[model samples]
Target: MVFVALLGTGTAVAGQVRGPAVVPLPPQPALPQLPWLPPLPPVPSISVQALPPFDVEPLDLDLESIGDSAQEAVLQSLQALGTLRESASVSVLGSLQDGFAFRFSQQQPPRDRTEARAEALYRSARESIDRGRYENAIQELDRLIDLPGTSRVDAALYWKSYTQAKLGQRAEALTTLADLEKRFANSRWLKDAKALEVEIRQASGQAVSPDSQNDEELKLLALRGLIQSDPDRAVPMIERLLDGNSSVKVQENALFVLSQSQSARALEIIAKTARGAVNPDVQLRAIRYLGAIGGPENRQVLDEVYRGSNDAALKRAILRAFMTGGDRARLLALAKSETSPELRAQAIQQLGVLHATTELADLYRNESSAEMKKRVLQAMLVGGDADRLIELAKSEKDVELRRAAIQNLGLMAAGRTGEALKQLYSSDASADIRREVINALFVQQNAGVLVDAARAEKDPAMKKEIVAKLSLLRSKEASDYLLELLK
Candidate 1:
């Protein structure tokens, strides 16, 4: 038992030197709170009369550890900041030792503080803001802004934008952002600055601008002007505006202008936007504009919109398309289901205007509204249904609508409705309808009217004007009337 097993005999026992050994030690003292890194700007150009004649107000908190009172943070922050002012040394020292220990400790005295240490603190503020530590960072960066020769040019501009944005000085933020983007484009803060600039531009463009001085207004004006002079440029700008910041109305205006460009991509984007488009007015406008740019390709792309949805204005847009590519049977099918009375009537009238025949007469015959039926009958005259036009002129009760039908019938029938026109020109109750009949009669045979007009003219200009009207009529009557006028 006394013979301890020398198990370590094979290895070097105690004489071998080891490389290093881990050791436990007492905790190192934490570093004391240092002065702000750089000195602040000399107290502002105030005449020094603005400040209190006495020392700073007595601290409402204890001078031991940082107080827990509501005033502690503001008190400590102010005391810490006061170090930047050399004249405030005695007052700051009193705040630290006697009334309130706003800093980390009461043991540290003002005389013992290092300005270099203060510079470090100021630098920490800038670094904090750069890292987006807004609450803690603003005060620190503000202190640093006073420091000379550190040339925190880009940092200063950035923190200005950041703090102003936090303080809701959006115009100021935008100004600072623009300056940073311009003067400090190469700085690390430039990307964020550019972002803020975009926000302001997009914001002002999309909605109301702040009633700031001339410069901010100028910036917004320049961007909006770009929208008109260069839509391609404008469109890209609006795209970037959508990135992170835009009011809803701003977004809609951007989409609206882009939609109007009629670019293919713009159309697709508009269609997609239509799904979530917040304002129904903007959405319907987009759809109607698409219809106005009508073509087979246009309609095909908008086919679902035409067939599925029931926005009245949008449906009117689709129905209006039949003005060119009319499928009367299809229109008739859609007509029964169509809810809008106005559009239904327009569709009905367009039918007569495009391809009206006596067989479709039933559609117009049963139409009760004299105003609308007159539109149908007028469409018939234009649509080559001359006999139908004459029939309406003979029987229609609304004097003006009937006169329009009769006048158009005379033109289409080429003297076949002459008797009807003569009656309208001579006896229609309405003065306008009589004038319309006179114009139509001239269209039928201008020489007689031209002679009468020239005979009735009291002024030289009137005589010349009547002859000019006859010349355009290009009738036998016009030639005779012109010959008589020359005589």
Candidate 2:
């Protein structure tokens, strides 16, 4: 049976499918009527080339397919995915295929017939090992490793060690694994090799670390074993690895193993490392892992980091960490109080990304800086605050701020957005703002409104501009309306 690896560890119990989430609409206040365009001044003939390019590059609509190298069982599973009615199952299947495709693409291709034969032999050896024919597997793997043209000697070496260990050749197996490690440093089998080596050492009553040597890889191997069998014992070793002695790669791996542990001591060590690691990369890694293993405590630590660190980069990282942790209260507080206006704007934008509409609108209401208020308008758009945007369009006193509101409203194709634009067009006396409203209607591709407006318009310049905008639309209805205007 094919099993899809889920993103999280928790088992999903099938639950009842629910309807779409209902967003509660905010109350819109009454809008005032604006003056219509005044009587026509003489229209200067405008060239159509002055308009912006209308044709955009369309996105690829082709469906992605499974790679040809997929195993038969995997291919069958993908084929059956279309019949699944549940969204959950479809999501799981999609992730599985994506993961499989990535791994399949990473596999090295055989160079020639010699390499192909070596791979076949290697597969046969793996089959032998699975069937408990250790001697035969070892013989086959050794032969493959000795072949001059074999591209998969790393795999052959790994399986040889595995089969040797199966036959109780611990010392020989360890030697073979060392050879594999030294020769194939970039091999994908390195992690499994390290794991198997550690297992063999433990089973043979050999110490994980000998008294004389400081082998970093061996220690890392031992650390991995302890994390699984006894995470309490693993914490100190992990802390040691994080202490500027180990390479960044080893330290990051240590952080990954530490994150996997469920022990309170493990979490405490992670928090401590996140706070105190002098290495910025290590510190960043710990912070990200803390975000992944989120809780109130982790959120508090990030909040403290944001308050204490003067490093803009570190503060930015903390902002993202808080975003990941879903600490909206902290984010809102930062958005309000951050001394740096740029970071304050970033925090407000993150709040929008998190869909904190009420808080964002509140910020917009009190925001004193013109530039910062524009950012707030952008945040409202990101948060899908259509009603709030309409309200801002109607109520904003600053002309530029109101323009910003109307501009973002154009991004929405909703009928309400079009209606808000029409209302603004009728109420505001500024021709420039009315032109903006017409541009917004163009953005919504509302040709019918443009036709009606064009028909009723007395200002020849405004009418010409409306027709020019209408010329951008390619729909049959838009074409028919333009023909009628010409007639």
Top-TM-score structure, candidate number: 2
Scanning candidate 1 in windows of ten residues, the lowest lDDT window is: 46-55
Candidate 2 lDDT over 259-325, as tens digits, reads: 8788988888788877853445557778887876889998888778777777554676677677667
Specify the poorest-scoring 10-residue window by lDDT in model 2: 53-62
Query: In order, what lDDT does every prediction score?
Result: 0.49, 0.65
What is the Cα root-mean-square deviation between model 2 and the actual structure?
20.0
TM-score of candidate 2 on Cα atoms, chains taken together: 0.54
Cα lDDT of candidate 1 equals: 0.49
Error of 1 at 187 (Å): 41
Model 2 ranges with Cα > 4 A deviation: 1-229
- Per-residue lDDT of model 1, residues 1-487, tens digit only: 0111111124455786777777889899999998888752231110111111111122222244333332223322432333222233322332332232222212223421222223344446544644556667766665645554443556566766756765557797787777767765666556556655655555555653353222332433454566567766666655554332443234444555565564566666666544433334345545554555555655564556667765444555455544435446545655434565555554664454345475358766666655456545544543456566666665777766666665554344333555656544544456545445544544445356446646765557545545555655547877776676568
Clashes (candidate 2): 4
* Residue 293 shift from truth in candidate 2, angstroms: 2.5
Q: Estimate each model's TM-score.
A: 0.34, 0.54
